[model samples]
Target: MSKALLVHPDDSVATLVEPVAAGESVTFAAQVVTALTDVPSGHKVAIRVISAGDPVVKFGFPIGTARTDIAVGAHVHTHNLATALDGTLDYRFTPSVPFVREAVAETATFQGYVRSDGRVGTRNEIWVLPTVGCVARTATRIAALADAAHGGAVDGVHAFTHPFGCSQLGDDLAGTRSILAALACHPNAGGVVIVGLGCESNQIAALLAEIPEARRSAIRTLSTQLAGDEIDEGVALVAELVALAKAERTTVGVDKLVLGVKCGGSDGLSGLTANPLVGRMSEAVVDAGGSVLLTEIPEMFGAERLLMDRAADEVVFDRTVKMVNDFKRYFLDHGEPVSENPSPGNLAGGITTLEEKSLGAVQKAGRAIVSDVIPYGGQVSRAGLTLLEAPGNDAVSCTALAAAGATAILFTTGRGTPLGFPVPTIKIASNSGLAARKPGWIDLDAGAVLEDGFDAVADDLLARLCDIASGAPTAAERNGEREIAIWKRGVTL
Candidate 1:
């Protein structure tokens, strides 16, 4: 494998695939340059002289402006680079990217639970959701009791606890209700028991009214206020759900699957390895007629146009424009920088700016056309690449993806995280080191892309994911790290 990788011809720097010592000769993109200083693996090395304030290009786009004159072979990172992004800006619908539809070959399939409403689920579990944070512990206790008694029958019994639904008004209350309603209808849950605290803003009756009519039969509701014994009532409801979800798995086509592509704790190798690998998997799933949801709006700041240009129609392009600009306005509205990302872990892992991160981050979408753009807590309607409105935060974005109808999430990480979503989260490590060190966190190692190429790795990943969809446990599931976090963006009374 090459010691360094230059992602684009005009890039001023190349990513060192492996750590290189000072004075060591590095070859990238067929060009040789001696390292002037020790550069860590996944870090950048200047390939050419860059004047101060000049743009540093990567992925054939400017990532940031150089803070000082950068000499060839010198290390390039936050110390010498600063984001060029500011507040919200005007956008035009210029859909220039061509969308090629690949013919599905043989049509891949997985064994999944097919719901009565025609939706497919990768897991057969019972979910307990609280209508208010006041009942969070009660919900957890109920889930624990149910899992201890009834987990062996279905996939498992789990509860998603959150601290909202009360003291929230307007969009905040609506957002919480939407997410809960979405979870209630998720196919993964064989039965859903909605625990309510009686008079919370997110009342059970109101929340149930929002759940899809087709999925309402599988959902059960219980109010602690009306229960003779809240825990006993919750356990009984969960038991009923388990019995309802006890249906056998059936062979379903890949098109029935909804895959969520995301990356957190990203390092420079993320773009080259895991992200690209996940992109191939995304392309495969899309080609097979499945839907792929890509979130992390702020991470697409500089790379937004690339996605916009691939919009399926003028309406999608317009919606994509709104999604991007609205996120920027959100940042500016709060006195925060629009490009406030490449978090500490991201920088430590070698990402310099949100642009550089965005360019790499968007690779998970592959080259699919944007079929739609869903709002913060909206459900997915089409079967193609849909851009969901969400922040760059991990748990919040993953939860949004789950609420948007993803059965499984493919999360690529270079730095590693133990967090998991309400759904199955298959962790792909960008580097082999992280995979080796965090065996309990990573399900696949995408570093093989550098040695074996994306074709082989993606093929393997797809097969593994199909197995996971058939009820195989992911690293997160095996470690019992399931959790959820809703985006609270409005007034909280």
Candidate 2:
């Protein structure tokens, strides 16, 4: 293994992929130097002496500034590196040089189920939606019954239960209504059975009204109280929905697809490798007249301006701005700084600030024009590159995207994660080490782009996407790690 990796020639620090003991001499590229301090794996070490307040550069950008005088070869981390508001940060939205499109198509297409609304779905399943926490158990009972009865003919029955559907007012109530309606109408969902208590604040009529008229007929609503609290009745209702969903069949076309892009457990290699490869695949999907949804509002903090510049129209840009501002307010109202992101794992992976992470995160959006920005728990209507207002947490983001009609999700990770959504989640490893170590979770190794070539790795990713969409199981699906979480906006009584 190499002693250290210099991400850029101008970078003053080098990343240590493996633990390097102090006083050990190692070679980096063309130079050999002794380690002044021990450097842990995935952390950085200074290659030259840095005075107090000097900026520590990584990925050829200022990640943070040195808090104390540091000698050459010293370990650079949170102890000595302090993230400040003032720094020499640079962002490239429109590249100074145009990106050359690499032409390589395999005439690849996936067999997906087509919905009446002209949307394509990778999976055909009946959704059991609970409009209020009062009926969550009823929803689960329905899913269990449907799974047992139609386990052979249908894909699967999923229970999308949330803690808050009632006791919410104004924007919160509207948001919940919008999300549940969107999920009921999702292409992946052939039929929906909504469970609710008769007197809940989130009324079944209100939720049904939000859905398109054609889709409302496919949804069956049940009230446990009205049905004599007979769990058997709820089960019977859902079993019929499962049979109705099984009637839908798979078709082929790009126009029927809605893809979501997400990243978690990110590292320095994320932007350099996996994220960009996903971006390339997103571009291909967009070019084919498909939609790509990018969410995790906090991850787009510093990068909002770039998306604003790419907005298709003034309305889109304005919405994008408001979404970002509202998210900042949400965090600040709770006495937390909007910049207090970059979890501990991120710092260990060499990301120092929210801005640094955002710069890397936005690469997954590709260069597509921003068509629209939807509020948290809102449905995605416009095509092209759309932004969904959701938390940066993996499960919440994936759940919101799935509700917004994403039939599949492309998730990029560096530290490695094993979670999947109700829809197929294609996991791409940012580096080779994690891919090799966690073979069961990582579906594609994007690390090859860092060592070999981007085009070849990109081709591999596209091929994997087609396979996953065509019914080949991803590691997440095979392991049955179908996790879901919705972003709740209001107080529950």
Candidate closest to the true structure, highest TM-score: 1
lDDT per residue as tens, model 2, 1-493: 2366676888787776557788876556677567787766656778888889988776566766789998777877778887654312333334223233643432558888876777777887887888998888778887887788875677878787777777888887887788788888887777888888889888999999888899876789887778875567776776777667755456565555688999999986677678889988777777666789999988877666767778777777677777887788888788777778899888778666776678678889888778888767677787788899889999889989988878889999989998988789999988889999999999999888766788788878887888888778899989978766766767766
**Reference-based lDDT, each prediction:** 0.90, 0.79
For each candidate, C-alpha RMSD in Å?
1.4, 3.3
Q: Positional deviation of 323 in candidate 2, in angstroms?
A: 2.4
Question: Which portions of model 2 show Cα errors greater than 4 Å?
Answer: 1-10, 24-34, 47-51, 70-72, 86-106, 247-251, 313-315
Where does candidate 2 clash, by residue pair?
Answer: 120-256
TM-score, per-candidate, Cα-based? 0.97, 0.89
Pairs that collide, model 1:
none
- Residue range with the least summed lDDT across 10 consecutive positions in model 1: 97-106
What is the C-alpha lDDT profile of model 1 across 1-493, one tens digit per residue?
3389988899999998899899998899778999988889999999999999999998899999999999999999988999999877777878784756665423678999988778899998899999999999999999999999999998888989999999898888999999999888888888889999898988898998898687787888998998899999899988887877778899988888999999999999998899988888788888888899999999999999999889999999889988899888889989998888989988988899999999999999988888999998899989889999988899999999999999999999999999999899999999999999999999999998888988788788988998999989999999999899999988778
Please state the error at residue 300 of candidate 1 in Å: 0.7
